[model samples]
Target: MTGPLLQTHALRAHYGDFQALFGVDIALSQGETVAIIGANGAGKTTLLRSIAGVLRNEPGAVRFDGADIGALAADAVVKLGLTMVPEGRRLFPSLSVEENLLIGAQGRKAPGYWTLKTVYALFPILAEKRRVPGTSLSGGQQQMVAIGRALMSNPRVLLCDELSLGLAPVVIRDIYAALPQIRDSGASVIVVEQDIGQAMKVADRVYCLMEGRVTLSGPPADLSRDAIHDAYFGTAA
Candidate 1:
């Protein structure tokens, strides 16, 4: 209660023998939105996966709400009110849109601000297509389902990976437009985004990564465009 709602300390991750992250440290204060920005292969996704418990780390690597959660399994992490909307909608091909959203509530059903009704309201198109398979929706609509599904857990911390990937600007705008409402619901957010301008617009703080290590971090206003560019590409621009 005294410190950040969630944090990673000296976090590192690997895939088989290949290391993807190196001593990554970040934090999310309650009700804040933090953006993790980096180019391809900068270990942005790896950092999120490590924190979400998909790639287990040392016991003290990830702490959430004052508990060590790095070693816990993904489901266990979710039960404690931490969730991730992974890259790619990854919806259940066999399940209806409503059913896929309901799946998120399976691990943590205590309920807070999010539920089937609220999720549908957040993405009304989902309501219209509630009985249809989740995969049947358009790319943008499917992203809404992914976000809504994660919201159903009523998580204290929501980690979003690449919400703007492969979508048109208008659709991306609509999706990013939902972040403020999500923050108003009392959930801290961390978005891994490739759109630098969008990240600056939505984030309270931004962290740039290069070669698996944090190169820059600060509030958007406090960081200059040139500094961000240098940090993002490791070259002056």
Candidate 2:
């Protein structure tokens, strides 16, 4: 793939008459992990929603595999190998862990890699509680289920929203530890995060958003803390 696997060109989003994103542009290349960081309500989640096809926009705005998919619906986007682990772990309380995983693959357009066995291997705890209701697991364990559910689709690009929302430091660590394995499994990732340190650690490239636009974007190693601080808050660190 000479070009990016996914690209957003001047993407904008609105809710009723209130706009949340302002001509945002971003990209994800094959097998790379890119992190989007910002404060609360910085349009980070909105960006993910737009790319994942939860929020519709112009067809030219979102290009996946060099094709316009911005006009597609959420389910349609997933069929094209783009899946999102939404901000909240909206697991079905009635479904067992394994059942939840199976639901994700129910609408599979084409299979590439992931399966029940592989998902269990990534989060061993899930295997032990495969028969348990999804809601009965620990926070980290539940998070694993959410991720595993998305992976079951065998997406070409995975979008993770607010991965470490409200968990203990150790739990957050455990969940993030699975990122490399996810990427290595042949799926590129775009993660929206609040923990700057954790995001910087896992991502090859980072984008700092403010209000509704990207303020700064570059490799994590190439950006200074102060620079990121400025982009994140629109002022001095």
Candidate 3:
């Protein structure tokens, strides 16, 4: 309660024999938005997965709201008020948009600001297509459903991985525009993004990852363009 709402301390991750992270540390405070930006294979997704409990790590590696959650399963993590909107917008092809959103509540319906109505209000298009199959919607629409689904659980911390991936610029703006409302709903957010400018705009603090380590981190205004460029690519441009 006194420190960060979510934190990863010396967090490392592996896929079979390949190591993806090396003692990575990041923190997010209540009602704040932190962005993780990096190029491909920089372990941005790996770091989100590690914190979301999709990839297990040593105990004490990830602490959330004063409890150690590194070893918890993905479902267990959701139950504890932490949820993730994954990169690909993994929605059920057979389920309707509303049904997909309902699935989030099935896991752990923590009483709070997010509900189907609130989610629909945030992304008005979702209300119109509530009866359609989730995958039948456009890429941007599907992403909305994915985010709505996560919010349905009313999480205290939301981990978003690649929210702008594969979408047009306008669609990307629409999606990013909703983040402030999400944060206003009383949830701290950690966004993993490749769009440096977008990340800089939304985040209270930005962390640049390169080669699986944090190369630079600070408030966006406090970080120079040259510093970010060097940190993102591991060399000065």
Q: Evaluated with TM-score, which candidate comes out highest?
A: 3
Better of 2 and 3 by lDDT: 3
lDDT (tens digit, per residue) of candidate 2 on 133-179: 99999887888899999999999999999878888999999899998
| lDDT accuracy of residue 221 in candidate 2 | 91
Estimate, for each residue in 148-217, the C-alpha lDDT of model 1 and write its tens digit: 9999999989999999999999999999989988998999999999999999999999999999999999
Predicted structure 3, TM vs. truth: 0.98
Each model's C-alpha lDDT?
0.93, 0.92, 0.95
- RMSD of candidate 3 to the truth, in angstroms, is 1.0
Write model 3 residue lDDT over 65-108, tens digit each, in one string: 89999999999999999999998999999999999999999878
- Runs with alpha carbons beyond 4 Å of true place in candidate 2: none
TM-scores of the candidates in the order shown: 0.98, 0.97, 0.98
Q: Say which prediction, candidate 1 or candidate 3, comes out ahead on TM-score.
A: 3
Clashes of each: 0, 0, 0
lDDT agreement of model 2 with the native: 0.92
The lDDT of model 1 is 0.93
| Candidate 1 residue pairs that clash | none
RMSD of each: 1.1, 1.2, 1.0
